[model samples]
Target: MESATLTRPPAGSPAPSGPTARLHVERWPLIGLVLLCAATVFGFFYYPTYPNYDSLYSMLWGRELLHGQPLSFEAYRAPTQHPLAIVFGAVLSLLGQDGDRVLIAITFVSFIVLVAGLYRLASRAFTPAVGLIAAGLLCTRFDFPFLAARGYIDIPFLAMVVWAAALEQEQRRRGTPVFALLALAALMRPEAWLIIGLYFLWCAYPASWSQRITYAAWTAAGPVIWALTDLAVTGDPMFSLTHTSGLAEELGRAKGLSAVPSSTIDFLVRLDKAPVAIIGILGFALAAYLVPRRIWMPTALFLIGLGTFVMVGVAGLSVIQRYLLVPSLMVMVFAAVALGGFTMLEAGRLRTVWAAVAILTVLGGVYYTTTRVNLHVFENELRFRGDSRNALEDLLDNPKVRAGISCGPVSVPNHKQIADVRWLLDLPKSQVIARTDETQVERARRGGVAIYAANRAVLMRTVLIDGMKDPIMTQPLPGFRFVAASDGYGAYVRC
Candidate 1:
């Protein structure tokens, strides 16, 4: 496709007019967005939480780097490290115990950036009204906020990619700024490698040789740095790919190519929900019919996102919902267009009827959300994440538990708590063992401090409910005397 400038209404369509149009066209759009993001941050400030499992490992590895220690990427069930995340982790690790919460704060900022990027892209491609609707839809999707709150690297990765796309939409062949953002995104997720590569080709033909070389260098940085990092630490350039695949298989998360079709549909429905999914399809069709050029980028993004998801499954990596985030986001944009793109039409009966349809669709969505959405479930989950982490910290900080750690390794019920315990205590891998490992069962039995769930909720979520089928793993080791207890966790030492 030829590079095109920012989208304008098709041919002779009249420019937006009247009060509604004036409201959308003014400076208030950006001001309103700023206020919304500010409110969101302030509202959630009190509920500061730690990183998710993968992100915690990033901080741990970063701490190792900061202290001149080799990264333990080869540790059992270790997540693949992203270059930029590790760098941020190394910087944040300087904060010591407060690093985790700071990382989460950065994630919240990234989420805001993502929402703004979505608005900019959609608005530039269509109108400010569509942009506002897109932003609203994204905020309403609880999963996006939930991911941001949990400090998932995916949030930042999405932010970079969305902003890159928005910049490109603002001015086609945007060059370095666009490539720079995607390069940063590529450091966070390998999926961006594909995006940046395709973008390089798209812009290459119109560029001089030097520009192509620069873009190529930008394209190679993410994977090359990742490989070198892996090779330096694990002595295998392919360690991340192989290790992640093996881990996925072990965890029963890798679904093969045969399941891609079903998984794609299922994940999209889950992300966008059924009502928005149906509306997105209609909107996508309407946009395609009305102005194909306007939606080319979104259309390409939707396809590329799906293509990468398929590539992931084919490569034996874990096939999860987050992989489809790009496409789901496009669905939100297109759905916004269906609901508000009519505003771009010249005043007429057709515009009036379409506007009425949009209003009813929104009302129906509101009704569906009101009846089906339960705020308490989201509240409970967020509450548990904060509560559980605090409880684990309290248990680990207890003097008795600290004294017991000197006896031998610290053992948890399974791999779920490995990073948490290790990070909390700043202990080496050998110093922490998961009782679920058959080899470690005897070691755990021999001597060490073992942590356990303090209550039914914690037990069901942590110890008893793991991928391991071994019932014996959850049983208390013989001779372990209770040492310390906290609201969500308990500790015992066999020494």
Candidate 2:
């Protein structure tokens, strides 16, 4: 093989400088990026919106903790508790009625942080172009933004994991900071426990005995705190695990280990869409062939995330789509490489050809999205969430509804609206009942404030169970008389 000796610029004479240098120098400031993200969220996200069921439960639990009450994790259809989220909820609970919106705002910021972290990780692993493309793809994936807008804990958990990956990528074996981020993420999701444990092993190979001990402590922090919290409240160290499994069974979300392979492919396709998934696969193969070192960290993350998801199925936990988010994100990074990897190559005919292919792929993706994606449907769904929340609040605030509350508990069609009602009224778990609960149905029918869906949209979305399994849920109680109505809800009193 022919070889040529490489030499540096002589005596530091006129160091390399041009558009590329200026591009490096004029990087966006973190504060500026945050402000830009804030503006975008403010402009696009719906206002007067409440958190989703899981998040509202967090707020309610936080309020309970603030007022020195036990957490009602056993409440009908309550989601599994997340330690960091509860702490955050406790802080936001101080805001009273405004806490819900503030939680959404914080989630919006978490989404921004997630995007930023993805950009940083991708850029460090690949190039700036790839990083920007990956971040853009993530933003365009509506599921992620929807989760953030609804205040799902997954967004912040994702942010912390991505940032941890970024930090580790910036400097291999970056000890405490990366562990700290992963520890926080662990508090949010059990998946991070596996990640942090693996990371500890990687760090241990190069550390002193004391450093190993510290790393072990950080690795244990998430599960220990979680178990302790569960033990303290529910009197079972394994309450979260056992409770989540039972709830998954009740909700029909448990798919089992046999479904993992198919679920993995299905969820990836759902998150990244078919075209991106295909491109990401191709990109992974190509990067492995040409630049294994650069791709290794993201590849490790992809595998770990996939493994964690499979374990979730094995452990009989909820085998839902959100659990695949981290792997899907890594797929986005690979897909970006398929689009922008040409930038990393030296200027030549091969590079030109690859760049042309990338451009054509972009056009194809844009066409596919334009033809298949319905922006209006997404808009209306988000609008309904905000509108329904406001209407529910209005109904609860009605004079007759308040008077009926004094007479007896407030009852909803099912567990769907239980958290929302409790959060809105600051009512105890016992004070807001689901008609689906056979134990409460008799009491609800006797006397109380019964809330019903006021329109078709609300009826389908809130009152009816999945597949309209119970039509009677929307039927009016015999003795209840209509007292007041709002756009999406109707109030009746039996007192």
- Best by TM-score, which number? 1
lDDT of 1: 0.86
Q: List the residue pairs that clash in candidate 2.
A: none
Q: Which ten residues in a row have the lowest lDDT in candidate 2?
A: 1-10
Model 1 C-alpha lDDT per residue in residues 18-70, reported as the tens digit of each score: 98876657666778677877866774676667899999999999999999988
Error of 1 at 386 (Å): 0.4
